[model samples]
Target chain A: MKPRIAFFDFACCEGCQLQVANLGEALLDVLKLVDVVEFREVMSEKWAGPLDIAVVEGSITTKEAVERIEKIRARSRILIAYGSCATIGGVNGMKNRSPLEEIRRTVYGEHAHTFPTIATRPVDQVVKVDYYVHGCPIWPPEFIEVLQAALQGVPCFPPDHAVCVECKLNENVCLYDKGVTCLGPVTRAGCNSWCTNNGNICYGCRGLVSNPNTKGAMDVLARYRIPLELVLNKMSMYNACREQGKTP
Target chain B: MRYVTIPADKMADYITALARRQKVVAPVEKGKGQFAFEPISEGREATLTYIPTILPPKKFFMPQYETLLEYDLHEGQKMQAVVELEEMVLFGVHTCDLAGIACLNTVFSDRPKDLNYLIRKNKIVIIGLECVAYCDEYASCALMNNHLPNGGYDLFLTPLGDRYIGHVNTYIGDSLVEEGGFFRDATGADFAALEEVRRRKREVFHDEVPIDLDEIPRIFAHSLRTTIWKEIGDRCLSCGNCTNVCPTCYCFDIVDKPNLDLKSGRRIRVWDSCQNERFAKIAGGESFRKERSSRKRHRFFRKFRYPVDRFGKFFCTGCGRCSRTCMARINLKETLAQLAREYV
Candidate 1:
């Protein structure tokens, strides 16, 4: 029987969902292996029945999101948290850095106190996630690999090393040499050093590795004479939740 | 052994002749003091005098990504082993890089031979260029005893003022010299110029690190539990950049990439690094080198101790790529000198 797969989002840019949609001809090939029962972005069809696999694509930032993600966990056999938002709370987690009231006033202005929000938490923090497709907007190749593994009942391994590995393999000149402070030395791999390839330093959108050498990363900053506040500010963008002891 | 000389003016013609015979990969400046081994159709594109390319010529022998086998599910697990290769001439390889290739050759050519690497290595010809002076402060080639040509190339070129003294090491080099017709018989004057160049180089290059090459293994043996690893590990980002750019580091991981149909896939080998957390991870979720310091120590031992014990030679060719490419500025010479001070 084809696995009944569904994609859901809570607090995200929906760019990861667009990546799946932008799979071009590969999406049709993937359809033959699994039955995508509910993909709100690409289809109008929605299934409330039990799903074999549920691919969630955002951080849980609201009280309703916490409840909905638990329901997803209860219904699906395998749950995948994709993108930086779904897996690591992403930029949404940056909200937790400042006072909630002040942030609301800044964004909603007069509409403050009307919108109820909670600290951003990853899908894994709410419920168990069986697999992960990590990146800001997921790399399409990794998405396919993760999907294949999910379908075959096998485990897919994401690179636990730093982004510099892939960056070096791509033969791109080290960003540090170009006077750019990159978070690649501590950032998790699997994005294939996407940012560095395009002549941009890594902002660590995929989040830091499982066991990052943060001290070493700081040493790199010091070696290049880059300011600590600059890198720390960049780190807070997608990793504030992880830093604040929200998720493991 | 045959000797030939190519005048400075005909250097371009010599390279053009080589390119005309086959695909030629030579150093081309990438601006901002960076150079890369790129294919050039014209002789003028080859930058003979430059520091080491970002990646060594190991890219040609054992490519970063190499497909090992193509399997098809249609015929009940039909598989065909294959090796991707090209016939070409590699030019402007420095002595340090040539030593790096020699180390790789020793590894892949060892018992339980990697037929794929062996097959591809034979297809390419090597032309080495002597480094008259030190590339930079990062290089420790003198310490590694790789500053002089150790004969990993078919033809070795030594620049002496207006002409290049070429040492033809093999039949291939002799045939090239004869076929290209750009080289003339090496006169006694040219020989004196070559000797003078070598003499001058001897004075220029010296052990950058304070330790002797012979004492490296002894120091490494005793310094296994030294605090230097911890100190370096504290600064090492576990980025795997050090090993990736290393010429002698040949570790790789094999993976199967199934096509969209999920019917068949091609199994390929891609470069892997020991510094990676998962590099030492086992099936039951146990990582041998769990601590960053241990992984850091392992890399040092691989270069200094383990390879010397196994291969009877230091795996480190001292190209200084590991130091040069390190994001954390973990200087190889500094590390080695510290070890020597502690244990020697």
Candidate 2:
């Protein structure tokens, strides 16, 4: 029997969920391997069952989002954190630095008294994640590869290198030399350095590499005479979860 | 003629002649203080006197993404190994990059040879340009013995007053000289000027590091567990920037891309880096070099230790790309000097 697959989203633009539909022709190949039982973004059918694979996108920013993700973890055999928001809390985690009550007041205004919101965190903080599909809007190639791996009952993961590896392979001129700061050295690779190849520096949407040398990264910034605050800002942009972990 | 001269004004004429017949690729200014190799339609677009391109000529030799085979699943695994080829003249190659290409040649030409690289390499004509002074402080060509012209290039051009002397090192170079129609037979006085320029260049370029060439391998052998690697690893983002910019670091990973129908797909090879934490990881998740310090040690040793033993010479061409591109500000020359201090 083909494994049942479902995609769920919360507190995000759902760009990562849209990547599934964006696969174009390759989506047909994916259809042959598994049945997509639920994807609210693309289809209308909301069949709920014991799912084989559940791909969750976005951060648990609200109490309601946390309950939904915990339910997802219980129903699915394998749960994947898809996109940076799901895996690392991404840009949503930036709110954690500010008080949640202030953010609620800013967004909801008079309704802020009724709506309950919490400090933003990844799905993993709320429930176990068997795999991760990382990026701002997840690279389509990796999404397909991971989906294929999961279907075959094979475990897969991202390359444990920094984005600098892919940037070099693409033969891009170093942004650092151009006096622009990038988080490539400490961030995990998998996006194939798309941001750098597109004439921008890496924003490190893929979170930090395992065993990251944070001290080394700061020293390097000092060597280039780049202000330490600039690096701190870059790190907090995507790796806010890691920063929170470091302190607490 | 083995040696020929092109008037300073006629340099463009030669590039135009080459461009008319085949694609002529050379360095072109990208932005402020940046340059890249690009195909030129006119001779004037080629910048002969520039620093090393952001990418080495290796882009043409072994492309970052090169298709190796195309397969169709519609039928019973029908497949065909393909080689992509295009004729071109590579102008303004540096001596250090020449040595880099030689290192790649030695690796790919070994027993289990790469036909794709070998076949494509022969399709391009190499014209080497000599660097009179250091391109920047990052270069250490003097230490790698690549400051002087090596034999990898078919034509070696040296800048002389009023004209450029082109050494027709191969038959192909000889043919180009004859075809261009602007070159004149190099007089004996012209050769003397070439010798004088080279003699002066030796004074200008010297070993950028404190260590001797022969002692590099020995130093690496002794410094296996030194804190120097730990020091470097600490500052390393493990971004693999150093390995990626390295001219001789040719490790690669293969990937396959399928068409929408999933009936057909192409397999290609992209460059990989050893400094990556997972480069040596196995199926069982047993990583031989899991620590950042060990990965850094492996990278340094590859250039100085393993290649010297296998290929009978150091793999590093001293192009300085690794140092220049490193986001962590890890200077290759400084690292070598420190290792030398520890070894001695």
Candidate 3:
């Protein structure tokens, strides 16, 4: 029997859902391979039943989102954190720097009395996620590959290697070699170093590799005469998942 | 040891003959000192004596944009895993680049083998050329222990006076010698000439940086709080030139590009750099390395410290491409020296 699949969203840009639509024919094929019983972006048809796989996109920023995820987790055999938002708290987590009340007051002003908010967190922070498809808008191929692996009953894990491995394979010169600093060394592999190919630098949208030596990275920047505060800030981004309350 | 004397006259015939029998690629001059590896039908176009090519021979084994899989959405999302590879002979590879290929071999051949890279690599044969001296100031091969031939080639060639001393390293190389009809047994004088070249190379290539190799990780470890990162980060535009030119900087981003019909698409793994502002930022708006200094520092440690712990070797081949190509004038040698001074 085809595996049942579902998609859920909480606080996000909805780009990850749109990215799935961008899959085009691949989406149709995926639909055939699995029963996509609950994707709000593509179809209005909804089902309330146990799902074989649940792909959760976006981060949890409110009490409702937290309660919704728990329900989804209880009904699904496997839960996948899709996109940077669902897996690493993503950009929305940036609001975590400010107190929840302060954030509401800053954005909603007079309406702050009615607005409810909480510190943003990836789905994995609250509920167990069986897998993760990482990226700003998770790459479609990786999403498909993970689905295929699930169908085969094989666990798919993201590669733990750094981006420099792929960059060297592509034969592009290093940004640091060009007197610019880069984060390819500590960032996880799998993106194939796309930005670097087009003469741009890596933004580490996929997050840090397993056991990344962030301090070591800082030392290298220091050697190059880059400022400590700048290095600290760069590392602080998306790292709220790893560093919840620590400064530096 | 075999000594082969191909007069400048019969060189093209020999090259053409090799091309016909096997896939033969050689370095062709592309103006100035720049060279590229292209299919060679004749010897005249081959730059036998050239610096490291702009793109190393790694391209043949792992094409920049080779398709690893193809998918069709028309029928239930069907997909086929594929590898586009060509069997070829890569001729005249510099020692440093050959070492770089060796590094790649160790990586792809590791557990969870990259079948695409492995299979394609097996189809090609390597013929290494000895670099008697430095390719340019950008090369720090001497510091990295890659200045001399470390045997990643099937056929190793060393220029010996009027002739070439060819060391056939594999059965395939032996077959080429047997079929080419241009080789003669090596004489004592040929061996002497090869030895003399080696002796001269030692004198020509000196350590570019004064720090010892073992001291690199320690220096970086001790100097984590140094102000060097701030200076470099302030000046760096984060253009990613340094990682692009680096011999080993390999971060990537994977994307799915669907056809207009929206039925099928190919998953592409594109090169990515960490210098970009958004590299570590998540969709929720959080950034791991938000400042240029942190990103800049991350790049440095990857080369000097991180890889040393993981791969048991420095990822930096001392190929000064990063320093040479930097728009911000962030000299790698200068950075290392400063770290040495501050941390040592």
Candidate closest to the true structure, highest lDDT = 1
Model 1, span A1-248: residue lDDT tens = 88899999999999999999999889889998899999999999999999999999999989988989989899999999999999998999999998998988999999988898988888888899889998888999999999988887888878888898998888888777888777888888998888888888888888888888777777668767889999999998889889655443
Error of 1 at B158 (Å): 1.3
Candidate number achieving the greatest DockQ relative to the actual structure: 1
Q: How many angstroms is the interface RMSD of candidate 2?
A: 2.6
**Model 3, B308: alpha-carbon shift in Å?**
21
Clashing pairs in 2: A216-B235
Per residue, candidate 1 scores C-alpha lDDT tens digits across B28-139 of: 9876687889899899998888988888888889888899999999768899998898999999899999999999999998999999999999998888899898888999
Better of 1 and 2 by lDDT: 1
| Candidates, DockQ | 0.72, 0.55, 0.04
Candidates sorted by lDDT, best first? 1, 2, 3
Clashing pairs in 1: none
**Residues B253-322 of candidate 3: C-alpha lDDT, one tens digit per residue:** 7666554345576776555678755578786868898777898999999888887787787777765767
Stretch of 10 with least lDDT, candidate 3 chain A: A239-248
TM-score of chain B of each: 0.98, 0.97, 0.91
Cα lDDT, all candidates = 0.88, 0.85, 0.75
Model 3 Cα displacement at B138 (Å)? Answer: 9.6
Candidate 3 docking category? incorrect
Give lDDT tens digits, candidate 2, residues A165-248.
787776677777788888877778889898999998888898888778878777878888989988888888887876655310
Residue B313 lDDT in model 2? 83
* Candidate 2 residue lDDT tens string, B1-344: 38988988889888988889889998998775767889998889988788877778888988888999999988699999999988889999999999999999999999899999999999989999888889999999999899999889888888896899998998899888887588988999999999999999999989699878988878888998889988877777777777766778889999876654456879999888787777888888799988778888888888899988898989999989878877677788999999999888
